[model samples]
Target chain A: MISSDVIRGYNDTFLLSLLTKGDSYGYDLSRQIRELTDDAYIIKETTMYSAFARLKKNGYITSYPGTVTQGKKRTYYSITENGRNYLKEKRQEWRITKEVVDKLVGGDNK
Target chain B: MNTIREYIEQMFKGVPVTEETVQLKADILGNLEDKYTALKESGASEHEAIVTVIAEFGDIDELLEEFGVSRVNEQVTKNYETMSESDLRQYIQAKGKMGWNIGLGVLACLTGVAGLLLFLAFQSVLSGALYIGLLFLVGFSVIGIGLFIIEGMKAGELERFSSPYIILPGDKEQFISEQKDYKRSFIFSIVAGVSLCIMSITPILVGALTAVLPILVGVAFSLLLIGVGIIFFTYSGNIWSAYESIKHNGKYVEVIEKETVKHKRNKKVDYVIDEIYWPIIVVIYFVFSFTQGTWAWSWIIFILAGALESTIKSLAGSWDKD
Candidate 1:
């Protein structure tokens, strides 16, 4: 399992990446994140909520009150244009970060 | 499902109910429901699903802080400080009753005084009438003492009357309006009390124009003070009741539960001591007065007993500290 602290900075990236496909509510996004990680990571409910609040506040995502299903209403979040750009930048940042850390750790292992 | 909902409500108790907060609560509950359903589908028992779902829901404070809302619990702690709900209610009710009992007792004593003054004023009129008046004075004094004792007992009984815990339901706007009304009433009561105190002394100043009128004016002033004091006392009581009803909102469940446990532990011993203390002091006063025929000095026994009772209480408190 990936430690949450190791992935904390990328939580917005994960959420925004999920919303890029289409709009999704909290539970659906959480489930998708867990599945994408092959059940090795579970984003805490609070973590997911904080990420959503931060993403929406920064204009990276927009939320709307979705239609109630079976008497339960959900807040659906969709990525913004700025969110797409941020996700692309985050992907590039991740590539550089992983490359540097992998080299240092791989050299130590060898 | 009902249990889950109740759990969610309890978790959100101290959070301010804004539009964003309302949405957050609904979203969390919806997510929990999904989790619970999934667990149950995977052949988890109902109890297991509830336990697992709750354990996974994470801390409520984090969510509240993330949303930038001030916690109601923290605000209650700051405002009320160390006063538990039961302690606060009991303190206020006891204060009100004490005010009432003292006011009525003073009035009763004044009735005896008035009767005695009547007897003295008409002593030369007829001996029979004066003796009858003296008898009435004694009767009134006894009745005054009796009423004091009875009222004290009734107040003790009221201490055991447990008030129900209620949450104030309105939003921030409603709370502000209610608070405004409370402050206005509070200021009005203080102003009335101060004005009445000043007015009460006016009779004495007016009596300066005449000789014998001063005594009559003084007596009237005392009665007026008692009347106004009682009015202010009860009005303050109402104000405190309103404050308590609002101040302890969202936190009453925990406060009341703690009070019940503490009350149950201390009640029996405290009740016995409280029930007998005043009666014993009264009995000592009567016994000393009747046996020694020292009415002048026997009143000192009450003052001494009051001092002794307080000293004993402080000693016990210090011992507990040790």
Candidate 2:
């Protein structure tokens, strides 16, 4: 399992990327993230919620009450124009970050 | 699933209610339910699924802190640890005094009923001077109630200064034992109260036995009930002091302080209204009783006053909510 600390900074990027596709509620977003990562990283409920809060606060995403299921109403989040821009920037930043880390640690150990 | 929902609710019990917080709670619960369902479908046992889901959800405090919601338990635990021994002793003393004052107030209220009963039994035979003496007893009881209320209020003021001592999570066994003791005391108090009420009426049932015997027995029963009820009431009050001291701590203090600040203006209005309301109601009751001699129906005003007080309280509460 991937430690949260290693991927903390990019949690919002992952969430916003999913929202970029379509409006999704909490559980659906979490499920998609799990599927995408092949269960290597199961984002904690807390981390997921904190990401949503941060994204919404930064106007990177907007939320609305979705269709009620099993007597529970879900808050559906959709990415905004600002969110798309933010995600593009994060992707570029991650590319650079990964390249540097790979250069430092990817070579075979003695 | 219901257990999961209840557990989540318990975790957020002291969290401030706001639109964002409500949404956060709903979102968390939804995700937990999904995780639990997925685990169950993956051939996990019910227990395993629940345990896995909960374990993976992580600490609630971290989530609350992310939203800038202060952790009530952390504050409470800190307060408990830092409380000085002298302060704790002072708090315990104040709490004991408050309990005694409240107990006295209840006893004084009960004495008013005894005074009324005495007047009923002796009104036919007693001289006008003695009748007035009975009225004096009733008057004194009411004054006693008022004095105890003031004393209780003073004790409460003192209690506010001393930090409350909370039972820590590590002391789970002690907490459970205290809870059990509280339950036992609560039941004992109820039994004592009910028995006192029944015994007080026994004299009326035996009134047909003899006229003089009825008055004698009635007074005796009243005295016994008073003694027994006071003992039970005091015992329960002591138990409650223990319970509240362990339970409240810093979170309780913060909530109370917040409430007082929120309702400060309303409380002042309530006080003034209460002062005016009771006197007006009393005047109306007496006027009807003396002028039309409708003592039976005039008593309805007290019931109306009770209804009016609750209506005002609810109105104030809704206003605060808005």
lDDT of 1 by residue, A1-110 (tens): 77888888888899999898999999998889888889888888888898888888789999998999878889999999999999999999999999899998768766
Each model's TM-score? 0.43, 0.45
Q: For candidate 2, what's the RMSD?
A: 19.3
- Cand. 2 TM to true fold: 0.45
In candidate 2, the residue pairs with backbone N, CA or C atoms under 3 Å apart (3 or more residues apart, or in different chains) clash, namely: none
lDDT of 1 by residue, B35-151 (tens): 899889999999999997787677777776666665665444333323333444454566566655655665566566556655555566668766776687688678768867876
Quality of candidate 2 docking, DockQ? 0.46
- Give the Å shift of residue B207 in candidate 2: 86
Candidate 1 wrongly placed segments (more than 4 Å): A108-110, B74-322
Candidate with best lDDT: 2
Give the number of colliding residue pairs in candidate 2. Answer: 0
